[model samples]
Target: MKNPKLITKPFAQNGQKNAIPENYSSSMESNQATWDQGFGPITMIPVAAGGLPPKGQDFNGIFNQISESVVYLSMGGRFKFSADYAAAINGYPKGAILQSDDEKKEYQSIIDNNKVNFNTATQAQINAAWKLFSTDDMLQQLAGKQPAGNYLKLGDYGIGGEFPPEVIDANNVKLGGIYAPAGAAGINFYDPYAPMFVMNRNGMYIRQFQITATGKIAARDIKGEWKVYSDDEELKTRFLGINSTAVSAKQLSTKSTIAGQEFYGKGETITITPQGIGAQPVGNYLKLGDYGIGSAFPPIVADADTLGVCGFFAAAGAGSKNYFDSYTPVLVMNRDNNYRCSLQINVNGRVATRHRSGAWITYPTLDEFNAKKSLGEGQRWQDVKGSRSSGVSYTNTTGRTIALSVSTAGAIASSSIQIFVDNVLCSRNEVGGGEGTNFTRHCIGYAVIPTGSTYKVEASSIGLWAELR
Candidate 1:
């Protein structure tokens, strides 16, 4: 081979290895033998002592950059996208993942060079270009499963026939007011063969109209032409009839009428004819024309219209006062019918009369009354005594007659005592004492002192007196 040489290394390789060797001989043939000694010793090339060669340094920087990209890719890192970032590139590459500027969503490019603008693109364009991986995408998937059409509207005409009264959207459920949806017009129930509705519990049946085979027809009221039967035989039923038209009296089984008049249903015509005054009594009770007798209707006689009678007295004006009779005790009352007083006889044969204020006083016996009258009006006596110096004095506030007696004691002659009533001298007396001998003397006597009067006794010399006031 002409100019053949051994090439060992390529340019700008990596790592810290020394430079590779290259040998070339001018015009060297393929089969020519080269001297073994002529061959140069295998020597290492000179290398930079402390660092890589210039080419290696350049290559190492490139490798470091490449390693960072690989680490990011292996860790599933996505591209950070912003408004400014999109303007720099036509599209993200396939397999590239990126987040929107707001960071609310992440998208992966579905095709090579997906060029759709996530923010500005239409929903269809974005979906074609990207596969969203956020919560919003999950919600979209769920939304696809909902009913196809929009929610129903209310108040539209022609409902319940071909067109339905649509169920209003939940947002507008209260649009028609408090009882909305149900309050919507033209709502119909498809009840053809069964009862319109039924209300019942598992064991207890409530109330419902029409018929039901499963639940019993238990209700508080039954109207119209309802009838009760046992074993297909009609039972006797008593009911109050209320009708707009009169029922014939001939159709009724009982002919007896109350108050001489026929009773009819509400809103019916009635004719009342006064019966002739009958002598025969109605049952055991007396009728209008029958004579009243016996205890139930005792005869009231007006001739014995006095107390202590053994029967009732019929007085013309005292009809409401009371039935005055011998057996009945009288309860005296005022004109207003309030209890005024009462007279009663005790077991001791004493007559005790009660006053309106509830005080009861008995009438005195004849002997007691006579004795009190003989005694006449009485006087109350209160003793009034004093020494010779003070004498005695009294003022009468008792509002009754009072009596006073005067006495005097002295040791000298001409010793005297005097009594006065209302400042007027009523009595005077003088006593004699001989040779220093003490003696006592009496006044004229007692004097009556009227009300609002003052009684006084004055003594001359040493004296003593007594008074009854």
Candidate 2:
């Protein structure tokens, strides 16, 4: 065998052979030269022995190079091409051990896997939340006279946007920014129709509106829910009351009687009264003053101590003279505040009333008017006949009424009923045809009485018995 190996020129280069033997040694040497030329020269010499690779140092060198510099990292700041990817390419102690079990991986391995979770979050939500950090505005605020620190955080004081008119639309119609328009008057410009709040230069509400002075309820509707704005002035608005649609009121229940109650779906409510004495009597009781259109009652200021008539309460000047003294009983109406008709009292026992002329016709209370009097023996003190020359008078009483009925025993020429109060002129009611049997009907019922006031009822001619009601 001398050399059948010698005969074969295994280390041949082209057609020539080197002085080296034609053996494995020669063959390997030739291959090594080809490998060095094709690739780069070996960078890491094997520093250890291991079963991991054909040559430990050779494998580590290649892997270390890929991790540090050789790998083509995109470097676009995108997920796949980021700096983190570059850190993960190496093997062993210098590279990432990517596995579901974190205990087997290093710091870079944990970071690399976390990238998937990062992409799962909503980008827009992240951008929006991050914008609220107000980094720039905070920095400027802290650097009022000096530069801000690198680590310290600053805030925008709740106001947002750039110093200039920031363009946020494609056509540039929406206009807004954080800029001072004129001499020290800073403004927050924005689209007028945008669902944003109007604020002052200090980033506070422009003006506060409240149902209560403390603004406890903030905003509410007559028939809907209320919105509270206690601590959140920056919250967007819904144009409360401005853009809201109207809804009709629905009646929930009704009982139209004295002391009866009525309820509406919109929370409106009312209750009838005995004589308008309790609970917002409104029309049930009499009011001393009123100023609505076609209002009848004028304010007569009575003494608070003794209820004595002090003076007439009227408006100032010109047409305000007769307005102080009420021409008729007044009812302060509030629903819609419309003038329905002439203010009149159609009570059961209406003893006194204002005749067409400015004269008061007084009468008696129901109790007093219903009592039968023998030749004015038991007649009421408030009784007043239309034909009476001097009307009846009573110093003090709770209430009184008046009743009048006339009949002729025989054919008479004429008969009339006249009445007056406090010497005020009143018209007389006369009967012309007093034939065989004549009869006329006149009755009075419940009438009210002021505690400390005097009452008077008079009659000129009473053919029949005038009795209490």
Candidate 3:
């Protein structure tokens, strides 16, 4: 812009060249007059209240939010994923939008072809996918597995995959991180099938005790197996030998057990071995009852169908309440089918076998009582040989005809069992699915018995017999 011509003083025409007179221009002296142009005072221009295109109102940015392949929206609220992402995630082809009825049919076909059975997903799988997503490819342990949706890589965040520990740390997960095998990796005794937890306690990472496949207690860089040896005569720990769990210096392969005459057709002896390493062998196989093989050694004993030493007195049952027929007894009944025996409550309040030949023999001494207690309750005891008195019974001593009021404990489903005492059927169909524990209390009424006769169980199961009050 060109400046307007400056106002001049008329005295300058005399050529006197006098100093410029003071107060020559009052308009220039004012501060506003210095910027005053020849044009009238500048007035403010009025503008309509138009603001910049709002950042939230960027139409181009909104359009770019979704991929280009996304078809137009219909009146319905459902938004279609772009064909590109859909194909990558769901194996759909390009332009497979449900615009027309034909397109809808194609969409249904895609859904039918790609649907998955959510019921098949396990809890571990479901938990892995809750908040899962792409960027976590490294953490998707199940990514390369056989995909149910026919995709090479299932979206990690989509389902059944975990975020890496790094991702978890970066995300500040509350009290969470990868639970990796911490002890020593390969040397840490890791069991993939088992639950493992690790913690850095005092700068030392620690975890559960890991047992080796060969049944050895091992640690990283630690030579040889360090077993838990007992110093006092108290603790008794059993160790699995190089080949067998129990080590027996002596083994007897006799056919028939002395007292019960349990059939050992396989010619394998029914040895009653000691449990734990020492704990004093509760020898006196006869003490186990009128049905066990005599063995010189403790621990490590097996017969044809018999495996453990505890099975000497009874037969082991299956998951279905020790399924067994009345015809077979697991143990034996002496040659004459009678044995000298008596029941007495021991210090532990247990009805233990006391006098069974020679001096009063006591089996499963105090320390080994744990293994013996399995017989006290809901254990499924069966009779393989199927003897007459297969359960625990007491002899009738007196000549007087006595009513043998025996109470039976241990719960039973009562579904297919015929419980009988002597030659008489005591009760039939008195058991059910919910009636199997001692807590359920299924008692048998008092029945008359011959005097001086031995009382014994007639069923193959863990049961209690007591003089009814």
**Could you say which candidate leads in TM-score?**
1
Cα lDDT tens digits for candidate 1, 1-469: 5733423333323554332113335554322223322222221223443321234443444444445555555565555544344444655678777776455688887887566656444467788988886744667778788957754345333222343234332222222212122323313212112222223344243222322243333221112121222321121112222112233343244453434235535444444333333456767654442322223443443322132322222333334332323232333333332445545454455566554435556787774564344211553332233211334565665444556665554344556777788889887777555676565444344577776688777776433344342
- What would the C-alpha RMSD of candidate 3 be, to one decimal place? 38.5
RMSD (Cα, Å) of model 1:
52.9
Which 10-residue window of candidate 2 scores lowest in summed lDDT? 98-107
Identify the runs in model 3 with alpha carbons over 4 angstroms from their true place: 1-394, 415-422, 426-429, 434-443, 452-455, 460-463
Worst-scoring 10-residue span by lDDT in model 3: 167-176
Candidate achieving higher TM-score, 1 or 3: 1
lDDT of 2 at 125: 33
TM-score of 3: 0.14
What shift in Å separates residue 56 of candidate 1 from its native position after superposition?
99
Question: Which of candidates 1 and 2 reaches a greater lDDT?
Answer: 1
Which residue pairs show backbone clashes in model 1? 1-30, 309-326
lDDT of 3 by residue, 1-469 (tens): 9744433322223332322222324553221211123111221222243222222222233333332223222222333323343344564333333321112211222232222211122334423322222233434556556555633244222123363222211112122223323223323233332222222243343323334444434232122232332333222222322122332232235444332223344444344443334445666545533334453322322222232223233223232122122112233223332353333333454333422322333455563453334322332222212112334454543233344433344554442234444545665434554633554536454454544455454443434333311
Model 2 alpha-carbon drift over 4 Å, by segment: 1-53, 60-63, 66-281, 284-469
lDDT of each: 0.44, 0.31, 0.32
